[model samples]
Target: MATRPLTGTKVFLILVAFFGVVIGVNVTMMKLAIATLPGTDVDSPYAAGLAYDREISAAQDQASRKWQVNAHIERRADGNAVLQVEARDASGQPLTGLKFAGRLERPTDKRADLAVGLAEAGIGIYRGNAASVAPGQWDLVIEGDAKGERVFLSRNRVILN
Candidate 1:
């Protein structure tokens, strides 16, 4: 049997083919990473910085109010989530006439966030339902507004079975 002689052209072609495969794989991986990126948490970092003082002031106001708010989240057998909030003043009196809203946020993906519209169930009790909540970790954010102004805000991490 006669073996073909190793030539410069063969060596060059081998090198080119090896580098081409590496480059192709790298490009494919880069494109996949970019396509799957979840993006920034905030749209404008400068705007968020500008609002920092306002957020601090709001936090102070909320602290001064000394409101007692309790939130409950329950997963039903139908794979829905039920949220209930009970709010009270510092004096232990039920707070009334406030609009409450709830949100179930997925920590890893912002696109999976779910908004829940809560209605006043009683004097200080607010209830809302979210359909088809998947079993996983979630950030539950509950906000209370009075006369078009936000008065209470809370965020808690929860896990559903």
Candidate 2:
């Protein structure tokens, strides 16, 4: 059998093919990483740090008030997101008379985030409806305030199917 020699053209073709495959795979992985981010819990690190003192003070105040908050997300039948929140005092009494709000925020894209106004159902229960909440992971933020005071605040990580 006559074997072919390792000519310049063969070497060039081999190098091009190898680099093409490697570059293609690297680009694909980079795109995927940008698409699915881990999580962005805070918008601004500096601002959060500056407000750290106030946050701690507020938390202490809330602790003194002895309020407990429970928050979660529910996927509706219509492929929407429902934010549920419940609040209670340390004495195990329901807490009410507060305005409730929440957000279903994506880690990478703020454009895909959802904001909803939660309505008080009964006995410290609040519900909010959101549209087109695609199945994946989400950062849930629940806040309740009355007369310009932070009555309840919660951040919960949830996964949807």
Tens digits of per-residue lDDT, candidate 2, 1-161, equal: 99999999999999999999999999999999988775566789999899999988887787788777888788877898878888888988988888999988776676788997999999889888999889888888887899987766777678888
Top candidate by TM-score: 1
Q: What lDDT tens digits, residue by residue, belong to model 1 across residues 45-81?
A: 9999999998899889999999999999998889999
How many residue pairs collide in each prediction? 0, 0
After superposition, candidate 1 runs with Cα above 4 Å error: none
